[model samples]
Target chain A: MEPPRALLFDVFGTCVDWRSSIIREGEALGRRLGLGTVDWAAVADAWRALYQPQMETVRSGARPWVTLDVLHREALDRVLADAGLQGVPESDRADFTLAWHRLDPWPDTVAGLHRLGQRFVVAPNSNGHIALMVNLSKRAGLRWDAILGAELARAYKPQPEVYLRGVEALGLVPSQVMMVAAHNVDLVAAAACGLRTAFVPRPTEHGAGQTTDLRPARPVDVVATDLGDLAGQLGA
Target chain B: MEPPRALLFDVFGTCVDWRSSIIREGEALGRRLGLGTVDWAAVADAWRALYQPQMETVRSGARPWVTLDVLHREALDRVLADAGLQGVPESDRADFTLAWHRLDPWPDTVAGLHRLGQRFVVAPNSNGHIALMVNLSKRAGLRWDAILGAELARAYKPQPEVYLRGVEALGLVPSQVMMVAAHNVDLVAAAACGLRTAFVPRPTEHGAGQTTDLRPARPVDVVATDLGDLAGQLGA
Candidate 1:
């Protein structure tokens, strides 16, 4: 098969260690507010757990298209209320919502991206909106050619429009673009849309006990242990 | 005034030397196709001359939204017909349309963007769509955080939606985002939308004998000689 002309990435668990980053942010906020012995890890999990259900609201047309920031804020409020922290200062809550914008990349993300970017156009085609992606890239040193995905399509992942529009935005046919994602479901969805796919597992994306997405649920064009391995396999 | 949080750039003549780049592409195409003694500079000017009128059709709702690529191709066909080069092969014509994608950046563009991006979110807020901007940025070594502007708004420059949506995409208020352009009218429109404005004159943008946009027609927050000066003045 001909090599893909561009690589579209899945940001959260794929490029960034979002779970760890969110926990770190939560713990730091807890310390700043002198809220003793908060289980930020559990809070992080709770916040992330709402991601899909929230997106489903829009994907299913139950709600209008809103930015990931808006969804994130809404999710954060629910998470806080569930944790009995509804009394937290609005300023701190706002900062915590932005913590998603400050995720740290997996160890190989930056270097691998730089290497792959030398060969193919590389960008995040994730659920995050432009501002969130920009802030995340700046903090993580992820060099993207463009931010393409949910915001551009006004639809969430698993929706064909998100992947199709992203491929079109790069001036390439779906067949000429490769979707690089850790989630088997994301790659599966992209493959269905006629794009190539790469699976790079992040075994501990949801912490060491994470069992889901430890392996690709189906075959992909390339499978590797990490971004660096994927880059090497792609000859980038 | 508080400093701007993001810097939105006007591409084409503002960041890349479009006139020279088009001339170069045209001349090279002419040579490869055995067409001799063509005045490529005139062709470049003619092609650019159609830019405003084409975008105006969309801006005025006389036509629906289309990518700049489509507008450029239509303009190119007209220019070719007028130049008595309508006999050019379809393949060559298609390639010529993509010449806009390979524009060379002004001498200071790369370094200036590098310096400025160290401090602020720097992105192209141009009439070009995402694919066009991505290709141009790659070819020009312009490191943009997020490709914003016309594509995002589905409207061209000088339109309020173009500037306002670009600012909103970055999660910044109009006052916290600065629109930098070589064109007086572009800056004026952006300023009217409540965005801060910086004018960096491109005296030779339309060629040595050109007279338009040599100076700001109205007051702007900052005026500089070029991108480098803009960066320095912005303390980036």
Candidate 2:
């Protein structure tokens, strides 16, 4: 197989452990607000669950455009109410919403990406808007050649344009670019758009025993254990 | 004065020594074509001279929008004919055009940007499109937080949207972003859009004895010798 010229990444579960980071940030927010003994992990999981449905509103044209940060804020409000964690201060709620921007990288992410960047042009094909991506990269030390994804496409992933715009930003054809993600479904969507695909399994992406995306559910160009392994496979 | 959240750069002469690099690349192309001893410096100067008028056509709507790469190619064709250096091979001309992507950074660029990145998000606000910016950053070892500018705005600089879109990409208010440019005229446009401005004059940008942009042509928020000096003044 021909090596891809640019590698577009799925940020949340693939590059960073979003579930764990969200739970940690939720716990910290709980501590700071003196809201003792809340179910932070459950809240995190609920919030993650809401990701698609909220985005679907925008995708289906039921709602007007809003940045991912805005969507996360709305989801956070619903999650907090569902968890019966009432009276969360507005400023505290806002701070908690920004936790998404502070997600921690998986152990091998930084080194592996720097290695891959030496060869393939690398950028995030995330649900993240450019500002969110920039702030997240700064906080997490995930160096990127550019920030692209939902914001650039004005549409979410699994939509063809997201994958296409990611390739366009790199000034390469879809065949010349690869989409790397922890989710097999993302790879499926990318493959449909003619992008090369790399699947890196993060079995514990949702606090272990994550049933979905345990393996490549469909054909992919490359499959590796994690980003570092993928980088090794790519000869980066 | 309050330091800005992001620093947007003017790339060509400000960050990289385009004149010498273009001359060198031209010389190499001339030698490879068995047309040695061609006046490379003159060619470089003539090429640089066409920059503004070429962009002005697009800005004036006399021509449809094209990426800077396309504009550069057209300018190259004209400069070659004007210099009586016609009949260059297509592949060689194409390769020579890509010399823009391989331009070398000034001595203090990388280090100064690294220092600046420690405190603020830094990205180019040049007219170069995404691919050109990406290749140039990779080649020059520039660690930009995100790529932004002409392509993002779909318009060239001195256009209000170009400066506005750059600030928007960082999720920053215009007041919270500073335009750091070697040319004061660039700062003037940026400042008109309510962005803070910093001036770092490159007296030798157009080869020694260059007359234009030799000083801050108008009032600016800060003035420094080079990027390092600017970073120092910003306390980065």
For residues A82-178, what per-residue lDDT tens digits would candidate 2 score against the true structure?
9888689899888888899899999999989998998889999999889988988999889999888988888998899999987887778999999
lDDT of 1: 0.93
* lDDT, candidate 2, B1-236, per-residue tens: 78799999999999999999998898888778788568889999999888899899988889877887898899999999998889898998888989999999999999999999999999999999889999999999999999999988888889999999989878889999999999877899999999999998888888888888978888999999988999899999
Interface RMSD, model 1, angstroms:
0.6
Best candidate per lDDT, number?
1
lDDT of 1 by residue, A10-35 (tens): 99999999999999999899889888
Determine the C-alpha RMSD for candidate 2 after optimal superposition of all C-alphas: 1.3
| Span of ten consecutive residues with least summed lDDT in model 1 chain B | B202-211
Q: Please give each candidate's TM-score.
A: 0.98, 0.97
**Where in model 1 is the C-alpha error above 4 Å?**
none
Interface RMSD of each: 0.6, 0.8
Local error of candidate 2 at A133, Å? 1.0
